[model samples]
Target: MKILLATDGSSHAQAAESLLTSLPVPSDSELCLVAVVEAPTWQSDVASEHAALREELAGYRREVEERLEREVERLKSRFGRVSGVVLSGNVVEQICQLATDRQADLIVAGARGGSKIRRWLLGGTSDRLARHAPCDVLVVRPRDDSAEPARGLKRVLVAIDGSASSRGAVERLASLPLGEECEVIVFQVLAVVRSFRMDIVEQSGDLWEAERRQAHDDLNWAADRLRPVTPHVRTVLHEAEYVADEILTVAEEHRADLIVVGHQGRSRVSQFLLGSVSSAVLRHAESSVWVVRTEDADVS
Candidate 1:
């Protein structure tokens, strides 16, 4: 396996590194520590500050390179091969291009975070990376960058909706080295219609029942498939008008360390859209998230 790990020298990024080391990553996997320094911009009117700005940017670049090297050295024990790179450009685009060039199987990154109100909102960089990256993305959010310690995740929640992308996420997650002690919850949120659909809702009662039964069966099948990864697998079914909100609520109730979701939703189009369930989860959930994509898309 190949992984492109992005860092911005934040406490959250350090937490991400600690989490990766705690996990049972493949022995022969290649790990790359990437630090992107967005090119600095200045206005021509600020000519007096040009020289000072240039010097400041240069010092920042040196600091970033030093940190990258240190991180690479630290991760050497966790992976068979480790390297570091310092790039200057759009952070998301650079990381995505690097993944495509290296054909990475996964990208691990820390969520953009802060204290108070910012805790629930994911930074734009991580969100865009998850949406456009060439491979799977793991967005790690340590409970508290200052108070919380780095540790392996014990419980994971996976949301599935009988979609191809959902199944793909399951398969991809199963390939990871989750210990037998790890607990996995295979969950699904059934959709419910309201308001304008009252007349049609009554007519589709039997159809809804059939769909519920199928969802239950699929949950069982998914749980069985995950038994190899961890015997502590369970299933939960929920009926709700909002899928993403339900997922977040369940994850919090269970205190899941990680939340997994498909790159695309059951409708396919909605997930690809900006406000899809997966996107919503990426933005709001406090837990770390893994977005898995099954099919290849144009990377340019």
Candidate 2:
């Protein structure tokens, strides 16, 4: 796997590094550690002052480079075939560009950062990468101080909604090497679209039946997709009005260590107002979430 790890020298980014150290990647896998020096937008009338700007930016760029070097050494001690890069630009843009330039298979990153309000108001770099990268993306949340491994996904939960995006997550789960002893839980949450109260009451029973059948069929399809990986797996069906709420509820009820989810890219404008579900999951879930974005999105 060609993995790209985006670090900002924050504790959140360090958390991501810790998770990468434990991932069961192949020994031959290549890793890229990246840090970006953001350019300030002040002093815009510098058409003739390019040299001055470069000189001013040089110090910050050097700092970012040094941090990248230190992180590279830390990762190298734990993983194989690692390299580092330091770039000057907007953080999210540089991340996408690097991922594309290197043809990374995955981009891994932290959920929250030192700038929590900025990230929450304007989706963080990790959230942006998940939406726009050209490879699979993994957003790792900081572990709860009280939560221990507890057998490592002995009861893995796969959230499905029968969409192409959800199918992508299911296929990814099936491809992973969950040892024979680990049990897989194929979970599908039936999303109930809200409408007029009369309409909801009129079709509640019929909608429930249809959703039940669809969940069964979806679980079967997901299981078959994983047939190449694990032959023994169980499927669970859940129904809830709100997608995020139900997912957290199920995770808490089952004490799920890892929640696998699919990401459908949302534009920056919409993300600014209503945050994406994946982003919400990262903030709210008690357990870690393994977000599976598009093939084009990197797993940072």
Candidate 3:
């Protein structure tokens, strides 16, 4: 497998590196560690300040390159192949382009980076990359202080909604080289729209029952598909008004190390017009989140 590890030299990035090391990827898998250096803008045109700016940029470039090389060397000791690259451009666009050029199977990144203000003003790199990347994206959140120390990728929680995108997520999970010890919990959240009137409840009882049965069928189908990948598999059906909240609650209850969900494959314009559920989970989930995009989606 080919994997792209995007870094910004922050503590969060280091945590992502640690998470990657814990995964059970093939020995022949290749890892590329990339760092993006955004172009800087100056507010003044003073000659001395311009020279100072140039010197500062050059020093920063050197520091970043050195740090990237060290990281590559460290990964090389574990994996059979590892490489590092330093690029300049828009951070999100450059990372996506690199992933496309390499035909990477997965892209891994830290959920938060060095610049809090920039991330707040512009959406974080992990969020944008997950929305736009050509392949799957794994966003690693920082370790929670209250939770116990996790040994590795043991428990995984996947949310399914009976969409093609959801099926694609299951297929991706099955294709991964997770070890035998890994346990997978396939969960489906059934949204119940309630009416306050007693007459409406009586009229919709049959429809509600049918919907519940369909949800159970879908959950069982997903579980069956995952059985070949790992022996330890289970299914859960949750009914809630809010799907994302229910997913997070189940993940916490399971003590999951990873949460996998499908991207709705909404275009940039439509995504802005209609909000995304995957984006909400990506932003709020405490566990590492993997947003899988279908192959038919336009990755550009």
Q: Highest TM-score, which number?
A: 1
Ranking by lDDT: 1, 3, 2
Give per-residue CA lDDT, model 2, range 61-89, as digits (tens): 77778878877877776667889988766
The alpha-carbon deviation from the true structure for residue 295 of candidate 2, after best TM-score superposition, in angstroms, is 5.3
**What is candidate 2's CA lDDT for residue 126?**
64
- As for TM-score, the candidate ahead, 1 or 2, is 1
lDDT score of residue 16 within candidate 2: 68
Query: How does model 3 score by TM-score?
Result: 0.87
Q: Least lDDT summed over 10 consecutive residues: which range in candidate 2? A: 265-274
**What ranges in model 2 sit over 4 Å off?**
43-57, 77-80, 115-122, 145-155, 180-183, 197-207, 224-233, 265-276, 295-300
Model 1 agreement with the true structure over 1-300: per-residue lDDT tens digits: 898888777777777787777777788899998887775456666766888777776888898898888888888878999999988777788999999999999899888633211232255788888888888899888875452434876999999988777888788778776887799999998877665868888888798898899899979988888888887999999999888899999999998889998887663113343247888888888788998877842221
Residue 297 deviation, candidate 1, in Å? 8.1
Query: lDDT of each prediction vs. the true structure?
Result: 0.80, 0.69, 0.79
TM-score winner, 1 or 3: 1
Question: Which portions of model 1 show Cα errors greater than 4 Å?
Answer: 113-121, 145-150, 267-274, 296-300
- TM-score per prediction, in order, is 0.91, 0.77, 0.87
Error of 3 at 255 (Å): 1.8
